[model samples]
Structures are given as C-alpha cells and as structure tokens.
Target: MKIQQITKEVSIKRSVDSGTEEQRKTVQQIIRTVREQGDQALFDYTKQFDQVELTSLKVTQEEIDQAYENMKQEHIDIIKEAAANIRKFHEKQLRETWLYADQHGSVLGQKMTPLDSVGVYVPGGTAAYPSSVLMNVMPAKVAGVKRIAMVSPPGKTTSLPDGVLVAANEAGVKEIWKVGGSQAVAALAYGTETIRPVDKIVGPGNIYVALAKREVFGDIDIDMIAGPSEITILADETAIPRELAADLLSQAEHDMRASSVLVTTSQNIAEQTAIEVERQLADLPRYEIAKQSIENYGAIYVADNLFQALDVVNQLAPEHLEVMTKNPFEIVKHIRHAGAIFLGRYSSEPVGDYFAGPNHVLPTNGTARFSSPLSVDDFMKKSSIIAYSEEALQRNYEKIAAFARLEGLEAHARAVEARFK
Candidate 1:
C-alpha cells in the first residue's frame, strides 16, 4: 500500500456510484413487469436469471423445519445468541405514544405505530449470510411489525440456505420467499399474486437489487442504496500492526470495490501495517478480491498528529471506524461521523458485524453523514395528534386566519372564521 500525506480532509473521501443509465433503465423494466404481470413475471425472471424453475415463490413451513434439522446445532445456537443481542440493543430504541396538555387546554401528542409489514431481501448465491437475516428482521420484530416477509435468491442446488432459513425463523420472520435480484425487489415493492406488497423493504443485495430499490423508493421504503462496504482505522504507534492489517483485509475481501484505509501519526506503524496487510492478504482465500480492493481503493495517510487523523476520519464518514490508539475513548469523543465505531484493539469490526447488538446493516459509502444504521425506529411510523379546546381555538383563531390569508388561502381563512362564528 502507498502512503499519502494528509493535505486536505476533503481529499480523503472515496467516490461512490449513483448508478448507470443502463442499470436504471433495466431496473425500471423489471419494476414495471412485476407491477403488470405479478407472479408470472417473477417465475419467468427466476428462470431467466437464476436458471432455477420454482414451483412456488413462498418458502413452506416444511422447508423451514428441514432447515432447522439440517443446520449444525452450534450454528443454530450462535444465531439464537446473536438474535438475542440484536433484540436487546434495539429494545432500548422502542418508543410509546404520549400526550401533553398545554396551559390553554390544547392537547398535543404523538402516536408511534409499527409498520404493518416489511420485506427483507437477503442475497443468495455462493455467499450465505444468516447474520443479515437476523440484523434486518430482529429490529422489525422488536418494533412490533406484524408481518415480516423475507426474500432471497433461490440457490442452484437448494431453494435457500439452511442457515438463512433457520436464522429467519429465529428472528420471527413468518414469510420467506425464494426470489432475489431486481426481480425480487420488484415483487416486494409491487405485489405478485403470491407475494403481498410490503410497507418497506430492508436488506442488502447486488447492484441490480440496489438499483431496483432506488427506482421504487417512493412506492416503498428501502434501507438505503448501499454502496461498497468500507472500514477506516485510526491508529498510532501503540496500535498492533498485524491486527490492524487483518481488520483492513476483512472488509477488503467483501468486494473489489470495498475500501480499507488507515490514518496514523506514526510513520513506522504505517509502513509495518502496510507490510502486514500484504502478508495477511496472501493467506486469505479471497486474495484476489482483497488485493484488487487494496490496490484500487485502499490508502495509508500519515497525518501530522492524532487531531489531523481525526479530521480525516470525519471527512470520509466511513461505514465502520476502528480507533486503535492508546486512549480509544479519548479519541472516540472527537469522532463526528461513522456508521459504527469500535474502541480499543479488542473491539474488532466483526464483533459488531455478528455478535454485537447494534445493527450490521449500517450506512455505507459515506452516507453515515446523514443516515443511520437500521433500527427499530426504521420499522415504525409516528402520527402527530392535536386537539384544541373551544377556548384555545377562539384565542388563536384570528392569528391562524391571518397567517392563512398571508399565504393566499381563502378557504383556510373561511374555515377558521366559521369555527369562530
């Protein structure tokens, strides 16, 4: 890895794809087809893309039971533990309806209601992430969502991964479907005869799935147009070179487009960490993917001091940030943006990715600046309540009518006048 001296904080940010015109056009067609043809379009696209003929779109209870029987007991135990952690963390975020009566006897309150249903899209193929099933579904379950519908690509050999099915079952997802890619997203957004339309869709997927989410955004809620996974490490001479290198490669192996960056004040550690990354890269099974990622998007920035490195970290607003300095908490207090922060060397990114209760479905590709991780809050909606007494209405009627008149709305003024009359 090459080292660059930090000159401008803005220069540290990575580039993100908004989507190609061709991708947008194709996704639109998929959305339109699913909207028009429903279940037939889903079947055709599954055969066309996945090359798998499906008798049914929905996963049967028999399959779920078989998944539980086939998966290792230890793996099942771990999924249950992870689900518990996730549920515990999100449980704190739950809110209740509350009302307040003003001095004028006007009442104001907010009613929080969970979304009726949600569609969770888990990617399928070679990679199986039972973790994603837990991360996306558990939060919705904690928020009290009634129907948690899940969709994933049908495996060439099997309809869905046993681990994924087991995890979904553990997370309380009732409906699981063997559909994926843009077509699956389309089916979720618009209803196929078999698949009911959901209030929102939450999960990760390939570019086609992401683009499909972008196209159907207003029609249905989407988690985010997730870009490549990313991780940034702010370390010093005290930080472990091998551990830092290992952490960088962990995210790098996610995809060729994934980014792994290191910002440090120590020159010696920067060079050693770079060498360690190379050493560790050779041992990784996904060496080619990690190597390409490091060569293209990876970087080592030698900053003037810890403060300068902190400035660079905030500028990037990375999806995952690891502070491996001597006083991690002291440094963490200065961080303004990051989807998730791991303090000290022991708190690796994967802890949060798998075991930690906080969501692994984080804002990626610098969207952490404005967005947040998927939480129970994402699965709930709030409606404001206002009830004014006659006394309260009479007192404010003139001001309300005047304000409406200032906006050139005669109907609004008349309504208020009629109330007073």
Candidate 2:
C-alpha cells in the first residue's frame, strides 16, 4: 500500500478507464454481427469466446430446477433473505401516476409507466455474485416491469452458477439466456430469433460488456458504463485499523483494477492501516489480485484534519464511502458525493453490497458526482401530460403564439393560432 500527503483535493482522483481502441473495435464488430446474424451469431460467439457449443440459447425449466436442487439449503436461504431485503428497499421507491388541476382549468401531471421489458446482464466466469442478480432484477420487478430477461455466460462449461440461477428464480426473472459478452448485449438490444429485444439493459460486466452497452445505448437504455469497484474510508483515530483494512480488502479482491483508498487525519492510524492491509492481503484467497490492486491503485492520504479529509473524499467521488470517525453523522453532512455512505464502524461496505436494502449497483469511476445507484426509476419511464379546456387554450394561445413567433417560425406560431380560430 502507498501512503502520501494530500496537498490538494484533485490529487486523490482515482485512475480513469476509457476503453482502448482495439477493445472498442472488437466489441463493435461483435455488436454488429449479433444485430445482423441474430441467434446464429450468438452461437458462434459462445463457441468462440465461451468455448461452449449450445444446442439452445434459453435455459430450460429442468435446468433451473436442477440449479435449485444443487445449491445447499443455507445458501438458498441467504439468497432469499437478501432478495427480501432488496425487494423491501426498492418497493419504497415505487412511484405513481400523478396529476393536478390548475386554476385556469388546465390539467398537468406526469404519467409514471413501467418499461414493458428489461434485460439484466450478469457476469459469469469465476466472478459469480448472486447479490448482483438480486440488486439488478428486483428493482425492475418492483417497478412493475412485465418482462425481466437475464443473460449470463455459461463460461467454459455449460453450467450456470446455482446461486445465480436460484436468485434469478426468486427475483421473478421471466426469461434467462445462456449467452454472454458483447453478443448477449447486442441480442438483448436488437432481438434475435430466440430472444426478444428489451426496452432497457442493466447490470455490470467486464470490458467487452461495458463497451457493448456503450455501443447499443441508443438502441436500448443501459444502467451505467461501470468501471472497477472502489471504496474510500474517511477515518479518524477512533476507527479500528483492522476493520478498516478488511473493508478496503473487500473491494480490492473484486479485481486487480479495483481501488481501495484511506483518507485519514491521523498519521499513526494511517501507518497502522497500511501494515494491517499488508497482513490481511497475505491471507485472502485472491491474494494475487488484491495485492496487485493494493500495490497499484490503493493508497492512504493523510489529511490535516477531518474537513480536509472529507474534501479529499468528495473529490474522489468513490463508489462506496465509509466514515468511521468519532462522530460519523457530523462528517456525513459534509460529504457531497459518493454513491453510498456507510457511517460508524459497524456499517461495513459489504453489508450494503449483500444483504442491505439499498441497491449495490452503484456509480463508479467518479460518476457519483452526477449519477446515482440503480433503482426502480431506472426500470420506469415518465411522460409529461398537458390537457387544456377551451377556455384555458383561449387564455394561453396568444402567449404561446407570441413566444413561437419570437422564434421566427410562422408555421410554429400558426399551430397555436389555429387552435384559437
């Protein structure tokens, strides 16, 4: 782990990842092929990338039942518990159609409508997190989306993770596809013979998946172009070094590109945390990955005071932020950015990642500055409503026409003036 003194706020900015040209070109070609060739292109790519020759693109009822049977009872219970939490949390975010009558006898309101269909992409390979399935799908379910389709790679083998399948089943995913990579994204965006096109796609994946989402954005809505996972700890002398180290490693093990940073006011705490992180890193099963992440992207910045430390945290706009200070509530008020905030020593990041009610699909790579976590709203769209009575139209017609004429468009002005006539 690296330790440095923060002279300025900008110095704490995490590394930004804009996809490489070659990666972009490869993803573009895959998207184009999937759009044109449809399921045939999916079969070819699955064989080429996943090395699996699939007889069918859809997961069967028998396979889903088998997935449920294969998982241990405890694991299934945990997934169900997490799903309940996710559902409860997202249900609160559900919106309703609202309208109001104005004094001038006009009605103005917004009609909240759920998307007809949605696609969720879950990353397969060695990284199989059932929590992600819950986070991405439950919101769409809560928003009243009628069809929720999921796509995940079968990996080198033809078997999908039992937990992922079980979680999907619990979340009411209507369709499940056994295709992945850019091809799956394209298939979801532009319907293949086997899979129907969805209105929006949401979830996290590798570089190819990210690029594919970027390519097919206009064709369908995407959650976000997520980058590597990251966490920032704003701690004081009150924070436990061992707990902080564990919190940092929790994200570091996600990927070698993952970032874990500590911004503290105490030099002693900083030194102890660095030592603790090294000790904890040696014990992780993904030690090599965590080590690489810690060595390259992890850092400890010593700030002059709590205010200065928060300044650093805001500038980073980390995906996850933990305030383990003596008075975390006071510190929280100063935090203007960050996708999620965990206050106090007990509120570790993983609690939110797995079982907590909040959606773990958060903004990454400084995107927290303007974006937000995946929620029910992402699965819904809204339309503004305008209904005017004869009198209301008469009252506003001249004003509208004048406004239109001021823009130098006679045709536009005439549209409103015609209503008067």
How far is 53's C-alpha from truth in model 1 (Å)? Answer: 1.1
Over the stretch 330-359, how does candidate 2's per-residue lDDT look in tens digits? Answer: 887799999999999889999999998899
How do the residues 187-279 of candidate 1 rate in per-residue lDDT, one tens digit apiece?
Answer: 888888888899899999988898899888998898888888999999999998999999999999999889999999999999999999999
Question: TM-scores for all candidates?
Answer: 0.97, 0.97
The global Cα lDDT (0 to 1) of model 2 is 0.91
Whole-model lDDT for model 1 versus the true structure? 0.91
Clashes of each: 0, 0
Candidate 2 — worst ten consecutive residues by lDDT sum?
9-18
Q: Give the TM-score of candidate 2.
A: 0.97
Off by over 4 Å in 1: 13-15
Which regions of candidate 2 are displaced past 4 Å?
none
